[model samples]
Target: MESNEPLYVIPERYRKIENLHIVFWLLKDLCWVMLWRPLGLVMIVPTIGAAALITWQTRHIKSELLHNIAVFFWIIANAYWMITEFFTTDDSLRYYAVIPFSIGIVAIAYYYIGLRFAIKK
Candidate 1:
């Protein structure tokens, strides 16, 4: 048997980090919807669909800078939501929700910074 193959291939410089960042943001957004929706898990289907599209489109990209910027905005939005939730005095459930909401904001900021570094290279 004989086989023929291309002698060389160049691996993409930004593939791994970009993909991971996209996945993290998508998951966090899904978590947000799940946490806020009245139906809980039922809201995850639309989140999953959006994630699939984002993953598919970003899988081959070599630039993550824009994605990082997007993540930063997402964190800011989440932080605002959490702060509002924390201030609500009517329900204990709203008070308890602030914990996870704040945690999600922190996670978004962390990943956004990481992705920024990844794009800098």
Candidate 2:
């Protein structure tokens, strides 16, 4: 039996940007791991920019919007934690990264707990 649900396809441009975002994210992390502060800090611009762009592009789709928003927050939290490690010896400040991390979690939770039920209605 054939299912009736429509296929969802991402545009090629969006897909290309998403692939590039991964490269930026990896470079950012690699820089952090190597203790290369300048490059790591620079990489934050493009990495966060790409994530913001992706979230904007997906805004029309509730599910994608929620998840991408979470991703945006996740990248911010990761970058902030990396910066803390790069600049300071105080490990406690790194805990502040939890703010963005928690936002991401709330976005996901809202989707799963709130939006999911709303969609079913």
Candidate 3:
């Protein structure tokens, strides 16, 4: 990663919007890991919304498409987990959800690393 580069280059006009996308990205993770346990189902609303905004902002960057896809999948997994919490009385099921959930985080990490290299180009 470029030490000076905090973000991938975007048109000056879209810089703020792009930054919002990053905030939403982090917020989605925050909402899931922390907020969902306390606030319950409402967390998915912003989680999906952030993922949508992220996809929209990064759509033109071909290198990010896969990363975005991984993110969406991860978000879906989280949504599934949240929904299960409501409908299932089984506590052990969440243990199983950890597999996909962990994969999503790994995918997001790959996206970040890929973005760093993509910007280097």
lDDT (10s digit) by residue, model 3, range 13-71: 45665566566546655655664554445656666776667667778875565577667
True-vs-predicted CA distance for residue 82, candidate 2, Å: 0.2
- Best-to-worst ranking by lDDT: 2, 3, 1
Between prediction 1 and prediction 3, the one with superior TM-score is: 3
All-Cα superposition RMSD per candidate: 11.7, 1.4, 6.2
Q: Give the TM-score of candidate 1.
A: 0.30
lDDT of each: 0.48, 0.98, 0.66
Worst 10 residues of 3 by lDDT: 35-44
For model 2, which pairs clash?
A: none
Give every collision pair in model 1.
none
Kindly list the per-residue Cα lDDT of model 2 for residues 1-121, writing each as its tens digit: 7879998999999999999999999999999999999999999999999999999999999999999999999999999999999999999999999999999999999999998898899
TM-scores, all candidates, are 0.30, 0.95, 0.50
- Segments in model 3 whose C-alpha atoms lie over 4 Å from true places: 1-7, 11-38, 91-121
